[model samples]
Target: MADDRKVALDAALKKIEKNFGKGSIMKLGEKADQKISTIPSGSLALDVA
Candidate 1:
């Protein structure tokens, strides 16, 4: 289950990098943190749901 999550996250990150252009590679936790930090708190509930 964890492996599947890692693979999915890698694929999603690759797609994001492709669209945004590459710089430094981030660990999964860092990426998640960055996303969560940037999103508005009100919309975070909608995102998780």
Candidate 2:
């Protein structure tokens, strides 16, 4: 259902936010070498498979 999807999406967003909030700096893979000031603290800047 749409409502269920929305709730699930919200939960996912919260997880991503929490992960990014950890403030752990990481090196990019061979292909990627970009920088971002802030993320939600330790999450990836891009979508993973």
Model 2 steric clash total: 10
Give per-residue CA lDDT, model 1, range 1-49, as digits (tens): 9999999998988988898867446665654334334555688678686
Best by lDDT: 1
Residue 25 lDDT in model 2? Answer: 35
Clash number for every model? 0, 10
Span of 10 residues, lowest total lDDT, candidate 2: 23-32
Candidate 2 residue lDDT tens string, 1-49: 9999989986776777688853333325534345756545455655331
lDDT of each: 0.72, 0.59
Clash list (residue pairs), candidate 1: none
What would the TM-scores of all predictions be? Answer: 0.47, 0.42
> TM-score: which candidate is best?
1
